[model samples]
Target: MNAPLTSDASPRLEDFPYRISDNVRFADLDPNQHVNNAVYATYFETGRVTLVKDRSHGLMPEGLSWMLVRLDMHFRSELRWPGTIEMGLGLVKFGRTSVTLDQVVFSEDKCVASAQAVTVLIEEATRKPTRLTSEIVRNFQPWRRRGVNVASPKF
Candidate 1:
């Protein structure tokens, strides 16, 4: 199996697409003094958006927009209030018409949660599913899953 891509051409974890460091805010904690479940989702989202924005993938592509098709999460541990957390994101699969985003939330040395999401590309004007362009695929290909080439069309 090919290693996960660190770039469009290389497949290695050392080429990790993006990493973000963030602190748990007072508002992020619930009465139990632990991070809220919804807040975990928000943190994962922030990590993903921050990476794409800094790396040149706008929140919405020109002539195309991505719609969320699915989201899955797993909580491994509880993040107590008062510590900084790191959020890591990677492009796990870049399919023809969709991309899967994988995110992990870490509280210092501990992994608090992990998540995955699938988003479908659609024509901006008509909101219809469209084939993912080569440029788009190329942008993600470097990081494609080792045994999976996600460039297949999906309606």
Candidate 2:
């Protein structure tokens, strides 16, 4: 008889190779002296932009643009000022015209927040969602969510 596996092979935040860092500013703090809640969204945006531009894996088209459709976030801990926020980004779901990305923000080596965002690739002329090219799909396959086998149905 064989023992069942104890460890799960699911992908985690650390599985994402893309990294983005930013320093919390005094202006980012509220009366509580912690980073404002709204600033978390900006951090995630910076991660996404960096993944698509600075650290892009050469999958996306040169001029590809995105339209963020929705963002579901959870704030786990307070982020203090004068600290660095290290963000990790991963592709949680891929669709015909959109992609759902999962991100986690770390401050002082602690996870402060996590978010899932749906962003659609849009055509500049029509301002509408466009299908992902085969090349892009191939390039993103290595980063697909570990347990997800199919693309998400919704944008």
Candidate 3:
């Protein structure tokens, strides 16, 4: 696992290797007039899913799929609707059967929220955790978090 980001930490968008942008919908707000806490998870998911599920990435092998097993989120600031938010994802660690990612949601240049998500690769037929193949590991190299020295992917 990567070092936990403190609430005071200000993460730069460039530190994340994979990035995407999304609009903040009015439906995402709560009674607080800001983005609902629960909605942050969805923003983080968009970053991870877009990278892993895209056929061009080759991170997903045939008969294998990824499943979210853990997610730790931090709310740094409030986000309101009527603006675009940039979501960023960085591969932080690789386990025998799981990969960990650090993700963030930034409104303008300030990080509004961040999360660490763990997803396990599973065998489609058995629904059992599956070891990561070397090919998949290699493909993920380019997505590593800046300044992170992740451990080698264990089979």
**How does each model score on lDDT?**
0.69, 0.75, 0.91
Candidate 3's TM-score: 0.94
Per-residue error (Å), model 3, residue 140: 0.2
Instruction: Report the alpha-carbon TM-score of model 2 versus the true structure.
Output: 0.81
TM-score of each: 0.75, 0.81, 0.94
For every candidate structure, what is the RMSD over all alpha carbons to the true structure, in angstroms?
6.7, 7.0, 2.6
Q: Which residue pairs clash within candidate 2?
A: none
Q: Which of candidates 1 and 2 is the stronger one according to TM-score?
A: 2
Cα lDDT tens digits for candidate 2, 1-155 = 96653222332556655678888889999999998899889989998887766435765576677788998777888988788888877787788788887778887767788887889988777787889877766676766654545464442
Q: In candidate 1, which residue ranges exceed 4 Å CA deviation?
A: 1-16, 54-60, 142-155
Clashes of 1: 2
Per-residue lDDT of model 1, residues 49-149, tens digit only? 66544447543457777777787877778888788987766677766677787767777666778777788888879998877776676566554445444
Model 1, poorest ten-residue lDDT window?
A: 7-16
**Distance from true location, Cα of 62 in model 3, Å:** 1.0
Candidate 1 at 76: error in angstroms?
0.7
- Tens-digit lDDT track of model 3 for 1-155: 98865433788889998999999999999998999999998888889999999989999988999999999999989999889999989988999999999898999899999888999999999999989999999999999999888988655
Q: Count the backbone clashes (under 3 Å) in each candidate.
A: 2, 0, 0
* Backbone clash total, candidate 2: 0
lDDT of candidate 2 at residue 25, scale 0 to 100: 89
**Superposition error at 67 for model 1 (Å):** 1.9
